[model samples]
Target chain A: MSYKDKKVITIGVVRDLTGLSERQIRYYEERKLIFPERTPGGSRKYSFADVELLVEIANKIEDGVQTHEIRKEMLRAQKKQNQEDVRRKMIQGQLNAQFGLRKGPTS
Target chain B: MSYKDKKVITIGVVRDLTGLSERQIRYYEERKLIFPERTPGGSRKYSFADVELLVEIANKIEDGVQTHEIRKEMLRAQKKQNQEDVRRKMIQGQLNAQFGLRKGPTS
Candidate 1:
């Protein structure tokens, strides 16, 4: 499927991918750990990145880390990733300017 | 200090390294999630790798993964890392042999 048209995964698909139980997944949602979208029928739909994050979370808990600490670290990691993305975009913009591409107005 | 002679860190050290409370670290030990060495005085001592694992575990929980599921994934990841290490060693041995080093007995 085209990137935009790729289907969002159901809760069952997420469970299978992450090897987590439905109850556990729902518990995570209740904890506000993940915020999957919902269908009009009230079923949850997870993005692929969400499933990957679940896998990463599973890996962390197995190592004897506490839940609250894990939440903090995940947020930190996400913020770091965002910063890296911004840096990459800035570098790309510089290269584009060198190549005579008119700089679009900075967002 | 050489790697082998580096002092084993006490439970307090581990707590600081992992950003976990003493009670939480003890609870993890009770769950058999970690097996730190004990001092003659009955205090827990953690290796650097053990503390690193604790950090990894904390990261996972923050991502909303369940504890048991995290445990399973951690084991899988550990096994994969071990296999990769073995493969690297084998490749290194092959390269050494090509450089005129005699093949050592296989472990």
Candidate 2:
């Protein structure tokens, strides 16, 4: 999921879900590793992808990867995901053409 | 220069050059905006480009941009730089063909 969805979620909840401490979560925010939304009151809120990223970052740190390396890895991961999406879309288009359906696949 | 080129300078030199504190420099390193190399003794060394990037990062931060946003901006900047390089090469190829120099422009 993208960062736009999942409004009304707070950092405390994210900490609980990701098992990352509040400080580390804030640290990640400060590092720009994750861009969580801040409320009118300045409380941090995380999206689903943000939580996933924090967990991923935690695992990467445990694997001896630094934050900048993790950022690079994430960029690579996002590029791969985009390529996969394009590949899937092409396959779906081919399938639709074979079936003679103007509408796209429901799935 | 890329992150691999410079390999003997220390964080102190970067601090002096950028006017960024040692902790903040280390913090940025931890955040991974710039990747400097380390010596065999584990000292951080800044490349010319790395130093430029640190100065850029300082400007971005002062302008109230977060690290993740800055990261995205940097990716865009790199992509733009790559496009400019490609455009330059294409022009150079055209010039070489017009000059009957398959070896390319002397300058």
| TM-score for each of the candidates | 0.42, 0.42
Clashes of 2: 2
**Chain A fold similarity by TM-score, each prediction:** 0.72, 0.68
For residues B31-90, what per-residue lDDT tens digits would candidate 2 score against the true structure?
A: 868787665456675654666788889898999999889888888998999999999999
DockQ of each: 0.01, 0.01
lDDT by residue (tens digit), candidate 1, B1-107:
43222225556546655788888778766766667876555766565567767777777778986668767887798899999999999998888878855657756
**Model 2 reaches what TM-score against the true structure?**
0.42
Tens digits of lDDT, candidate 2, A51-85 = 67789899989999888888887789889999999
What fnat does each of the candidate structures reach? 0.00, 0.00
Model 2 chain A is weakest, by summed lDDT over 10 consecutive residues, at A1-10
